[model samples]
Target: MKFNVLNLIFAIVLITNCDIAFSQKLAVIQIEDLYLTSPPIENKKTSISYLVEPSDNIVIQYYTCILNDEFSTCKSDDLLSSGETEDYSISVSIPKDLAGKYLSYCISAISKSGAYLPSENECRSELITNGDIDNKNALFSYLNQTKNFSLYNAPITDAKDDVSFVTSNSAALSLSSEGDASLIGYGSEVTNAPNLPKAKEVYSMLDGFAIKSESDDAIIWGQFDTTPSYINQVEEIFPAPYAMAAILKDGGINTAGDMVRGGSISSEAQKRIDKLLSKDGLPKAIYHTAQAFLAVFDMPSGKQKLVAWGQSIYGGTLPDEMKSALSIKDIVTSQDSFTVLDNDGNAYSWGHSPFEQHQNIQTVYATRYAFAGITTSGKVKAWGDSYYGGLLSSAAIDFTNTNPITRLCASDASFVAISDGNKGVAAWGNDYGAGYIPSNIQTELDATTITDDFHCASTEKAIALYDSSHLFVWGDKKYGGALPSNIPTFSIANVIGNNHAFLMKAMDDVYAWGGLNQGGCIPDGHQCLSSDDSSLNLRSAINDLSDISQIGSFNTFSEFEEEVVGGFYVRGSGAVVMWGNSVPDGVFNE
Candidate 1:
């Protein structure tokens, strides 16, 4: 390496004499106490920390050159401000790429007046090879200390290194609540995302997660193509069982993942399509179901327009009245028909025996094969396949003056309505589904003394009830209608259900029941039950249930709506915990 000593000397004299013209005193700027904070390491940033006098307006100029590369020259292109110090010391990061090479570095301070700080040029001159291993036997000495635990019964030994555990191939690492670390059996190598910020919000789609950062960046992991979409700030995401769409901050619409034929796309094409929607207007909201996707946009003409895609039951054509409606109040769907309620109290239905004419509709509910509407006067009307709750039975209509129906919910094949006064609940639709309230639950409902705060959820064949104090479930036992026999008592705070399973967050823990590989199972390390039937207490595995802010299923269901694939638990800290099947069975996005 060559140095322009004569030039530096000339520049220093000029700055020194110029400073005397103003301050009438020569500046005593100098770099002091320079040293490497740690030994240089391969493939890792090496820090050099130092303390300096009179830190203001000082710039740190650092130069490095590989020791044996005769063609290499030292360069000081990067300058760090002296004001950016920590704990009375400033640090400089040495590039991690200098592995297996001896390196020489020089650090000096320069004042704003262009005067160089006097320091020992011989300091940090010794040649040291960046931490590079030449022998396989020495690799263990560089490994991070790990606990003697492995998920696959492989032997584990504690190593002495203090760095993060490194994996060369497909090895997976799992950390326990106790901080015990284990390596899962190797499969494929995982690469970390470059410069990803901390996650702020996350949402789950059919088989992956959409993560939003505090910086407003949105990224996806699991089941997405490798190419990045480079999304703008995401405002909201609407995820359906089979497909998903999102609205950007600029009101541009982006859609991805899961198609009618079970395909998916990355955000690339979605960005191109965003131009099409941008010409119309910004989307106020987007909605999706297993069969189709829809968006409502505020047009430039001061009117709202609706767009639909995929195999919609309406066959890409909306009703004339719906197209001209001033504004849509709500839109809902059953298995074969889609319903829309307009702001003017008119309701429209199309596909699979659409209801003729409905007016003054306050609310609407649906089972797979039926639709029920409650008019402003509180009268309930039903239509579609009578056997699947298209028509209410006489018993279901018997609302007394004291016990009036308050709310309605549905399983895949049935409708359930709960009354206000005595907590009475009535059901109609397929018998084996939630259509018939069990006699035991009916007795409990009739005997209920409290009249408020009842929450309910349902799967394909069962309904779960959380009455302020107790949880009651009824329907088909095989599909999570009944609580698992070994589960602890329920003071359930919340409950979520996909088609085949139910997940409940209770006072002490979270629990699930149904098909083991579906939403019923938590991830391996967090399982509530051990192979020996000992209680692991899932909340302990998760640290605490209260940290979780929301829970939901991917909502993947079988063709007959008999099984759920997986679910997600979103923590208040913006970390999402996903369980069940993560990979789609077929080539969904290919």
Candidate 2:
């Protein structure tokens, strides 16, 4: 809690476990992926996916190590290498002896030269065991905790401290649409990415949606079903690189963003907002909503001003208190959470504050669930509980004392902070899976950051804009590698991430990877070109953008699916084309 008497601010999103390597070698051999049964047991089948350099012969070995505090090998298997395309899949059997125990394992590829490359789970997985909690001991349990996940039923409806219903005090948190697209109110218990709020049948469901993405939910703007005239007015106010947004048109207000199109604010929230907007009315909305933080730019009294709102939960509405607490400046959401920074350089934080106590602060950077602040003394402070060593780990915190962090981006579990001094990037967080960044690219992320005025983005992975506006990536390659071998880097106007990639090239062209099977990234009428190697939506409007003003992308991730499973995209021109496993059949067909 150190104070330097200066002001500063920061954005949150969660991530899936993934790692993709970017290599530039004469011959590269990589263990691209390894998927196995969740909580595996005896006789269950396990799998591995990998990549080998072109025309190279390689051998892959599956190695297993003891789970509980070990330093010894358990079993190993050597297998023939396919040395095939990036999307190859292979399988192995789970040993019965490892049932119930968490064993660490990995796949190593042996090159024709006997050179070996090892996968870094040093890979870990747990198998269901025969042991069960003693029934007598369970009877005396404290919270009646179960084996793993537990659901608390008959939830008390009233708790003064409960923030979920804090917006009940407002009139908008519960409102539904009346005229067009009325069915956008509720659904048949559909699903989205893990931890992502379900899509309500309202325009607000589209809040924070974008056009090219790697999310796990489907966002089909009104244009997908029936075109709405108000869409024509979207850009004049809510413009490019849009985030969580609220719109007022034809006597109605709805939500908009990179991941969704339009939906109504809950009734309670609307009422709360009605009170505040009694004089001038609700403002248009955010340009793009990342990290779930919302903001609007307005010209009050002839000068352009930024108005921001914080902590917009499900239903795309912020609590009444948040809007009321807003002041003069604008703030963007961290990937899906908030990093509270004040004008006095003092930060108020709870559980795991990323800042060091008694350290003067300059600014704070928000990870999906944590916060990292740059002290005026040029050091960093990360607060909040980190699930993996990827975040705030000693290896992740290797910041040089002389360099100051200039900007940052977050995947669901990691952080990519750029150095102002041109040294390199400071990245840490769920360093496994697609979030696993390439070792050599660390220099690229750093060089790209210090050299350009660009933005960083992520999903299960991460990508940053290089000097040419073309992209330089680390993290997982499914989304990162999807970038065409020859990107028109100099023309890239904007870029964002779901750890998958979406870009605005030449300020007119668009390219994406991750959710094309569902039409999330592919433009209409165009053949599927997703980086994940699926060909589903090749005839949608998004695939055919020309003279387009701007683009936005959205996605959700399912830990249960163990992969990003849904996505959709939107145009600043009001085109809402969606694609993903979660999308309705023929939803985006012309």
Candidate 3:
């Protein structure tokens, strides 16, 4: 046997070299693409990414743990090799008062030849309060220092960084400047950026105040404390001798030096007659007459008297030949008669129908018992008591044809007209709907104009005016024609009566809407006279009127009681207002 067969081949080569040094002293470490590029430090700034693989004589270490609440690991961080397969980046700055929670990381590889590597922990991440951090601690610190690594439980890929840190102070990390810094392409450190103002200019610059009229977009200003008690109830219900003799006889000024050189009175009418004579003063038995070249002021206990024939009818109480033959230039009245139009328009009347409705009358309209007139070729007349239908009896007219009338209105039994080439509108007698002339308004008969309301129960809805000044109404909307939603379509020019519907406006500006009781509407300052109202509760009480230049209306009565029958009238330097109920105060202070 050759030495016992060589001792079994040297014991099989020392048992195969002790199984190759125990399989090279047990080694295994792998980590790959671990990532986290900002986003996960609840109280703010963070970034972490890595990749490594080391096995042969390995050594890779990165560890951090702060677990507690029974999750155990109190706090750690040290073994950080960061060498093999090294690809790492880390930044963590969390502060907003860093409240706790679990956070663990591990990737240990050591095998430089004295090998004993088996540590690739990583799956514990969760520092959550705001959540973020999972790329398995940067891909297990990159395949635990990768060698010929093969890992299965892989997870660690989260990268989305538009660079954010809005304060938990890492120097306040937020760079997305101007216009969001060109939408994150970054390039804006600040340029012209100072904003925050308009809340009415920051409350008018914190109340140092200065915003008067940036063009007065008026939210509201002043002037309306019930407007001087509605202008002292329109000067105590349209007085001033029936509104200055219905504006010098309907403002065409028939005489009395055209109501004292009529420039249409209104520079606030001498400050509204010196504020109503300094608040109810003047007026008492002021007489200066010479054959009725009158100037009597009375009224304050003296029953009633305000007779002044034109120019200063004695406010200075004169008698110098009755102030030089009644230097009166105009004065007319009717509730029983009194007239004067001297200044050469010469006309006068006494009392009691003195010539029937005051013959030769320029305008007038009484009614305690009847009277009416209109002439100067506009023809219309009426007398008293035809049993309260007054008088305009052409056998109660059914239109036997007759024109040439340019306005005339009566109510309380009917009468209306606005003739001249059938500009349409006609009516007559005893309330057959007042004067019943509407076959659909005779096919719009060129409807030049028309108006009347006799307190209107239905004068075919009374209220009309056309020739394109359009303003049509049909029968008593409780008094006049209602209409007023903010009135814009304009175009009326003239139409009076005011228990409600007044309307003037070719810039003469007047406009009253309807109802205050049969007076129909006026009530804001009151005005409008001369147009039908012997009684209809005296036209509801009148309302609203302002600086007019002129206006008129009437139906009958003329033997010149200074005239007014089918009524209407207006004029406005200062006064001359009327609205039915038969105006008379010597046709306004004469």
Candidate 4:
């Protein structure tokens, strides 16, 4: 039999497969270049081609590997028949996580008997460059894949070689050149050339020569000569030449010889300066100037001082201390009537002073109608009608011609007197029922002072002890004798009498009995009164009030009178309140 080499080769492959009953033909698979639909050329779907032999029943498989780990294995079954050679292609999805260089799979045919043929491999074409190449000349060969060449180990040359030189030293040129070169150098050569106009050169030379001449003139005048020209030249060179002269003068430079030796003004000129300094205003100016100069030069002066002139009336540095001192003596109310001391040390009264009860005055007595004052020398003076019976009468049985009476008091028709030796209370004037001095009070007792109210009929019922807090009552029980069952045991602070009796407790709260309309018992809240109850309506008129510190009344019948034409007077902290018959307008001046 005549045999073609290609047919003989195919027959030998068939004969080697005959022992297995069915020939398992071998095929070669190749993935030369991978194409992808997505950007980053490596990321597109990959299709593979394979060469299949005749009589081969082949299956193709596809797989992707990640981080050198196998991920997906897929197969296309029965792709080739026995003894036939063919090309087959398959596509695979590129996994998004598959990056950098990877060994992508292109697997060959598997025999019909379920045996896989070996797969062919290719060198890893990079999916991504991994930044191992020079960036400036990195070719973006496929718009996505980068072709990086090894650059650092490459030989350096001035010209391009067989291997393309990405970077060349030929692009650089020297910046220096030999003689008479119009092209000075490479790079920024145009900026470095020396260029000057002829006019500028001439002007520069003239300016330099002028400066040197001026400098020489300054040196010659300042060191060699003493003429006015030289002085003016020095002044021109050094501004404020007086300051320079001062320095020179301080250095003891005087004559022309001294000036030639760079010295200062003479001793005679300095003496004139001293004389000027001794002058009044001149010294002050000089001192100020010196201080200013020292300050400007940052120099210190041991005796630097500031002088001021003025009288230190309130002390040089501290303030003065001078204040006024004053005090209060006695407060006289506007309602108090006027009374004068007579030549015989007796008290003479006048006016409608309801506080004293209308009466003419003679000697001090214990009668209720009368109020009297006894002199410190023991002389007695009396005034007003006698209220406590004949206690003020010169004919009383117990009454002695004592030279001096210490004190005396009077209630309704009653009077009480106190001498250094004896103490007694008496009653006289208009009696309201039992308004008389008690006989029980005639006991021998020493009294330092005595007081009574002629206006209160209730006052005639009781006599208050001098130092003791006890009260002695000997008359009718109808008036203030009806003490409340809960009367507090208190020391009597005071007893004020009007139509009623006002008992002031030690706590200053006042209690009253007998009458309320006569302004007798000034209630806690009521203050002043206007008219007497003697006219039409029998009601007492009271006006604006705040607090009452004291009150006084005269006759009981007068206090209880149906018509009070004249009313009570009251005093308060800021002003007085009056509402009686004779109330004046704006009495407070407020």
Candidate 5:
């Protein structure tokens, strides 16, 4: 039915029906992304946003139940005002008692006579409650959304007065319903800011000695100071000096010492790196420690150009003779050695390697003094300073010739791998005081993702994202395995092991299961932990944080301190939270 707004104003509007009725109708194409400005609460002015439709009479309404459910109250009739803009918004006085809950909305170009528009995804996210999420990255994957965010309150860093729940899928952010902007409050200004990269390509990293690569929102993580000098005398190939990661552990090997920013690699060397990484080789990142510096494939072209700081300024800078030599699928650099995985399913070692074989390798990792590899067929391989680890040739199993290993992880003294197609886990190394895969690790892999590292004393802690979608750890009864058993089992979205463990849950919360002491690892008294000190229990480290969108590890071994392993997470609110080391810093809690 068709009726103009002019006639509708003369009569009162009700929830079920309207006064006018006509034969013609207006169709609502579709409502794009919904940007919620008001914190999901009642009794305050709230805003909902969407783009404009061709129809002159666009009505936006909300219902008590689902928008699909009939007989719901009209939140506002005049909320669809987006003057001079393609985007539009509706602002209405919110009723009290709707805090921390989802609100459904409906928008339509219905006849003035009152009709609903049937659209795809009709009740889908027409409204999203800005409440905390319990599972940021669940296995069944609720949102299946991998987001990276950074929060900013112009006048203040933590301005929550006029909050907006924004996501990467947003079309445009609106500050208020003041204009045709579909956004409300401070968020509109945020989207309109200059140089904002659209979705997908939004994340970036910048690091280099004197020279660095960056985008508009690039965040400079870690710390290194250096002068921008290169080659025999100085070549400012990189604009910034020591601007990024990869500072050599032994700076004395370079002629310019720590002052040297970066060096050049042979064009031919670049080609080898490209072919080796093949489809997986995106862009080689800088890698180094206090004693080594490597800018793999360092050139404008993704060709031959890899340079390392060794053997005098550019030690391992490949010569033309070795240009087509080796294609590396992946690279892992320990404090003094490097393990390169070849595309042909083989492993290669240089500087220091305990074993010379790399047959059918799938993935590789290096501990402070040892190396480990997983074969495509699902088997484990090991080498290097075995120390207390049975990884030595004398071990009973044939690690070198083993095959069918699904996954592999390493620590300073031990090696762990998944076998039986992830049906079980096996560990070989020192496990006296640290975590060792309890005999059930094989059964543990049934529905889980492994995240392990050389925890305390090569603790060999086993951390996994379980089938139930919760984070669980075991191994050395002294490190992660010793976590309290009473920790909640809601959802453990992401985890990283750094001699200790850091677990990220939904709703901007982070937990840690680490401490040098024998007492509880939780800084605050734990609420849900078992009394048994031998059980693996995680303690809440930080809570009520911004929603988490992404998780990653951040480790630096040189200058910072001894074996300081940490991690970083991106919150839906766009804040970066870092945890590691006991040192004090404004960017992260030590």
Candidate 6:
């Protein structure tokens, strides 16, 4: 029975008296799958997103009350807050007074005919509130304790103000409703630009690269750089060696680079792009090399396909049949070519096929001018410019016969293949670049007994590793080929090397030895080792060493030549350290 009801009490009454006569009749509505998106917090807004069946003319009624005990009774007048909604979601303000106490909430839906779910009278949900998470560190701790560490897994947006929040260890980043981004925390600053959108999702790398998607995509590092004016919507951003490429929502590509421009897209590829745009295709994934971009698209026909385009300076393009997503499993690129390994382990070359067909390929590695692969059977092969490690040496063949290659690492012009158990090692490439291992080092490689913790790092001049209490260096001596007599031997956690220097992070301290100007020497005050002695100190100019997570390398331009010269250390606490001969010239504090 239905009557024009002006209050919730009458609605409840109508629901209770099912047999009562009314002026008009309506069907009862049902609601299911009721659940809370997240726990309510004290002095904070709690959002409840809901979807109910027979959505039309449905109303959501909710109320919250502080509970005294498990058996406490809640009266209608005891409701601390109450609200009604016709939309799918609602946010309620949890009062500060409720902190440290349990709160019960009742959420139900009723149809226009006064029919409701949950019959009447009982609250099915109770939650304890944690006092306000007003700071980034506290918020992260709460998320960690609750095991909901991914803060941005779901979009968090304030509809009325259009503000979004992004958190890092040191600060909270907010995009205001006015499209201004402000960093709030220790040493906080604001970059005022009336251009940023209320981001739905923002992706960031510790090296100061960030991009916010969902609307009018823009790049934010230390400063704001909006996407190309022609791009209406951005799906993803791919940072390549010398350029940045963005896949557009319309299946088109936009790029900012020295040699390649989105406007210069090939006519043939453009036609395919237009077809996808017309059908509203979706961008799936993207891969890029210095010279080319490969995009995967989900088409309207329910087929996943690939498209490739670039300068093609070295003949890089996918085969017609290989354009089908199923035909390719992985892709590796050399400076001028692309090698696609099919699912069956057969390899195909598009840009420069300098080698014969290879099968059963487990993995492939590349140098600037050559390619090498290790077969599933542990056999190794190489091809391309013989001068640049393209031709497998007799030593490689002999070494593999006794012990199959377990892994491979490369320098600009050399390849180092470590045999199984790391008991043996071999190299080939330009002789000056450490392509030929000295006989004495080979003897050491044979005698050294390696544990499961074996690690190898390579650079243009040498490879370094821990052997007992002494760090061994082998290769060209000009850079790091010779071990420094003053360097102490310690258990190393990780080691990384660039063109001319190496940084070793020991269990508690970090050590460096190589070209001083190229990052081999730790700047004064930055060392974890005190100036008086080699003892480890928790604090230094480099921050806390015990919390360091990993070290990464980045490319920097000096004297008009691009070189991978800098090392950035990311700490477990989200603090980052950038060190090297040259750091990018810009405000990186953001």
What lDDT does the true structure give each of the candidates? Answer: 0.50, 0.36, 0.31, 0.27, 0.35, 0.51
* lDDT of candidate 2 over 113-162, digit per residue (tens): 43333232223333333222111101101111111100111111121112
Q: What's the TM-score of each model vs. the native?
A: 0.55, 0.43, 0.19, 0.26, 0.44, 0.56
Candidate 5 per-residue lDDT over residues 515-581, each given as its tens digit:
3331113333343232322232222223433455444322211222233333232233433333333
Per-residue alpha-carbon lDDT of model 1 for 258-344, expressed as tens digits?
A: 445222432433443464466666677654434555566666665566655655352223445555424555666655556665544
The collision pairs in model 1 are 170-188
lDDT by residue (137-184, candidate 4, tens digit) is 111100000011111111111211211111000010111112111211
- Candidates arranged by lDDT, highest first: 6, 1, 2, 5, 3, 4
Which regions of candidate 6 fall more than 4 Å away from where they truly are? Answer: 1-210, 213-216, 220-232, 248-254, 259-264, 273-283, 297-305, 314-316, 319-326, 352-356, 449-452, 465-472, 525-539, 543-546, 556-575, 584-590
Candidate topping lDDT: 6
TM-score attained by model 3 = 0.19
- Mind sharing the TM-score for model 4? 0.26
lDDT of 6 by residue, 48-119 (tens): 555566787776777666665422444565556767778776666777766545565555666655453322
- Weakest lDDT window of 10 consecutive positions for candidate 2: 8-17
Q: Residue 45 lDDT in model 5?
A: 59
Where does candidate 4 stray beyond 4 Å?
A: 1-339, 343-404, 420-423, 427-435, 441-468, 473-489, 507-510, 516-590
Question: Which of the two, 1 or 6, has more TM-score?
Answer: 6
**Against the hidden true structure, what lDDT does model 1 obtain?**
0.50
Q: Each model's RMSD to truth, in Å?
A: 26.3, 25.2, 46.0, 61.0, 21.0, 21.5
Q: Roughly what TM-score does model 5 have, to 2 decimal places? A: 0.44
